[model samples]
Target: MVSRGCCPAKIGELTLWWKGPLWLHKEDADWPKKKNIYCQADEALLEARTVSHVLSTVKYDLSIVEKYSSLLKLLRVIALCRRFMHNASKKERLSGALQAGEIDKAESSIIRLVQASSFTSEIQDLCKSSQVSPKSVLLRLRPFLDKNNLIRVSGRLGNASTLNESQQHPIILPAKGVFTKLIFIYWHDNLMHGGQQAVLSAVRQKYWPLNGRNIARHVVHRCVKCFKYRPAVVKPIMGDLPEARVRPAQAFKKTGVDFAGPFIIKSSLRRNALLNKAYACLFFALLLKQGT
Candidate 1:
């Protein structure tokens, strides 16, 4: 213990995470070991793929206003004129119902898939069910939040949402990304915490949403020397037996010769005349030894 903070050992342990033991629950303890599905960056990769495909495909449209037009092409010109009508010359003006129109048929012009995919019940259901707007909840949640915590949820009808898995939510568990090690630290004593802390510790010493002193307690406890020498507090909570370890039993046999020399009262079997002799010497040897 010192004026600045409590230091357990001589050099004192390096402070690893700023949000220490209290943040212990979220920061160090909650990380998972296996590859999380969300980590595939599917949202990002899919967006990239869509952009590339669209760019590559855009150049191939026959788009010229000619007498010959495929059914899809006919609708495409009508829709394109409507989409760009505000930018088009006055005579080329067309209705802009494609996006604002409540009817799904408005988009039948652009792509064959759009019209086909509209029939998919799943997509229609998704559009109607998204009643929760981000502003309503975020506004109320913002007042309750302090400097340390932040809550954000943004998902449009057809877009992916954004959530930081770094902070684990009690109800909604974000997928755990890749982690370093998995060590179970009993929550009570806060012993044996591992994984993400080992990873994040490299980045910062003190993190936000927490005070200064508490951070030191966690960092010092995890240091190599301090952890090895930290006195084991074997109080309750550790149930009766360790119960996690097991071993097998075996047998051994030995045979050896030995000499017995002694000086003591005569044995009941000894009716020898020299009962007062200074010492008695006797030898017994084992012939063999075996184990069944």
Candidate 2:
């Protein structure tokens, strides 16, 4: 082991290039890029085939992790698992690279089980030392989550749109069909209203709107034949109207009169001219002063 600026890291031979901090990657040619050369400090990692060396070489881990993320440190953990899992017939990647929506459900299921098994001890220890509870593994399985320096929910791929839309519109009411026959008949036949006018008028008078379509629909629904025969709507019981006032001078104003006999009057024009005259009220009481 040798002393770099601060970290006492092991090296093999000082390669003619550089191994920059985790932020800078090989893509940043200026960020301390190195080709195989000389460095003695990395010898321990080389000998151990540790996460550091495998990270540079592992094909699967490199394919998954993005350069710019808090999850970068977890890439080393993935490399370690990749080495351990490589010998098996099944080539398994580590949970650190697990993406939420992007993974197939079946594959995600397996990844979750493996992750739980792999990190069980570390999470327990972290919980004990921090005097706080670790995030629930099951809850973290939620299609979206972001665990710092470990995993991210942003990478998950699945259809959650359908689920989201249903939540937005929960209580959709069923359509209101035709009103019952009884309701229609009662609306149509009331005395305060003229024949069918009473019914139509009543319908309008007591109409209740449905689905924002108002009076037009009310008339339409009340006009149905079945409900029409249901029964004439009886007028509700209200007291009789007050009688009209009549002038005392006007006789027989309300009741018509018939004359019984006529009186004879002589015409001044000629002695032979005789006129039959009788007084009777017209539409209203009228008195004639014929003497003038």
Candidate 3:
């Protein structure tokens, strides 16, 4: 019988002993079964250690580490995540409305989503951080923001800040780079067969993407339908004169008459009375050959 820890001191020693001819001397018990049992135990120990390591990691708090970084970056990331979630939710809702063929409802829902994703307090904070410049789209909206003309409303994408006009309820655009493509696509679909001015007008009523007019014009210019159906305004070529006006004719073949005016004639009788009350001067012209 082999005593535990007697044949070998370390695991390596035991492995060498088992691999060598020394194992042949252990004929008292089944060495193969013991080897299988030992292997299983080692695997179980490794798995237990792995699980413990994972649980230890879960106990730590990562938020404290994130706090050391610039706050603006964190806020921007949070705002971006919020906007993404809001857009996804609204897209689902819009899809449902469109699937039901409720066009008005879909349009209203889209407008609501766009309004919801407008500029918010996070954007204002970002602007105040000096990260955005005067030439930036957000900075250009400073006038509206300062005048209190734009109102902020609670929304899924943080807070929505936009204009409150009846005819032009413009949504302060978010993620200009990404939403510009979306806006162009929407305008193209909505204003199918419409002109650039029409697309611009339609987009202005609901959205205020940067360079919106240029985007609309670009989409219009790229539309095959618009190019194929555009009306041409070329001046028509003048034709030759009619036979009646151009052909020669006999003298007096045609005549035109006109009355000149009423002329007064004085008589030799009474000085105050006229011989004839009035006489109308007459004139006539005849259509003839050049010599006649």
> How do the predictions measure up, each by TM-score?
0.13, 0.13, 0.33
lDDT digits (tens) for residues 1-292 of candidate 2: 2332323342334332345434344465544435644434542223333355343531223223233222323334454444455446455544444444323332233333433343444334444552213454323322222132122222122355654322322211112322222233344433322244445444333232123134334544555563565677889898753332333444433443345446566665787787867564434232221111
**Best of the two (1, 2) by TM-score:** 1
Cα error, candidate 2, residue 20 (Å): 72
Task: For candidate 1, give the lDDT of residue 256.
Answer: 35
Model 2: lowest-lDDT 10 consecutive positions = 166-175
Report the Cα lDDT for residue 24, model 3.
47
Off by over 4 Å in 3: 1-136, 143-169, 174-179, 188-192, 231-292
Candidate 2 residue-wise lDDT at 119: 42
Q: Which candidate is the best by TM-score?
A: 3
lDDT at 283, model 3:
34
The prediction achieving the highest lDDT against the true structure is: 3
Tens digits of per-residue lDDT for model 1 on 1-292?
Answer: 2433434463234333222333235554465444641323321222222334343422223233233223333444565555574556566554644553412232223322321222233223324653324433222222121122222222222232353322222111012211001111122124334433442342222111112123334444565655676678887666552222222222222223344555555445656734543454433222222312
Q: What is the overall TM-score of model 1 with all chains considered together? A: 0.13
lDDT minimum window of 10 residues, candidate 1: 176-185
lDDT of 1: 0.32
- Model 3 lDDT per residue over 74-96, tens place: 33444444455667878653222
